[model samples]
Target: MCVKCDNCGAEIGLDGVCKFCGTVLPPREPVAPPPVAPGWGTPPPRPVFSIPQPRVPVQQPVQAASPKSRWVAILLWLLLGYLGAHQFYAGKVGMGILYLFTFGLCGIGWVIDGVSLFAGSFRDRYGLPIRV
Candidate 1:
């Protein structure tokens, strides 16, 4: 009869041990022992398995604003800079409204605004760093 190796599950040579994992086996036959002798008792209990915790990766949020848009900024400056349109684009709503009501009355404020927008000193509504 044939026997399968317990270590690798391979078919073993009928006369010897398995070649793959070097597992030994006894030939099929009942052994007539010298008899007698029996002792010891139950085996000890096995330890329970302890599971390890998995690590999680951290994620960063992205910035939402661009630093400046020259064309749009210039348009606001030309058309509504008197109305503080440029200031509004730069997230300065309060100042924009001030200019809107004043109608560029001083003219000086609008000129400063044009320079601010061109220089990238402006920020978007979110107050985040502006991308080019």
Candidate 2:
């Protein structure tokens, strides 16, 4: 009977080696697949309704106003507004430096800041209003 090498598709010799590709061939036999359980082929049915999860209430943190006084900020602005002393007092170091270099945007920003301060609309670096 003729036996062929599975790897190289060449005729296998009596020593079970493929003469063309030098591959050893195993004895030819019919291979059967493993038997499956009767009900394992199909998946289990899913539930029609899903359970509702409880909602959690999240609370936000509250920030208190700055302890710095508005009157002191106003005073600093009046005295050295061009130098951004009020900005520094209000914990706005970046704006203070900008104001110092640009002379409070050539005094225009100084006037606007003074208006906002007197009108009770000015805020500190922490975004809290500086009132009273």
* Full-model lDDT for every candidate: 0.74, 0.91
Candidate maximizing TM-score: 2
Alpha-carbon runs more than 4 Å astray in model 1: 1-68, 129-131
- Per-residue lDDT tens digits for candidate 2, residues 1-132, read 678878878898989899999998767677797877878776768879989989988889865667889999999999999999999999999999999999998999999999999998888999998888
TM-score of 1: 0.42
Each candidate's TM vs. the true structure?
0.42, 0.52
Residue 48 displacement (Å), model 2: 34
1-132, model 1: which lDDT tens digit per residue? 567897898889866689788888876686595645455454557999989989888879765667567678778788878988877887878888888888765898888766766776656666654345
RMSD of 2: 9.0
- The clash count of every prediction, one per candidate, is 1, 0
Which pairs of residues have clashing backbones in candidate 2? none
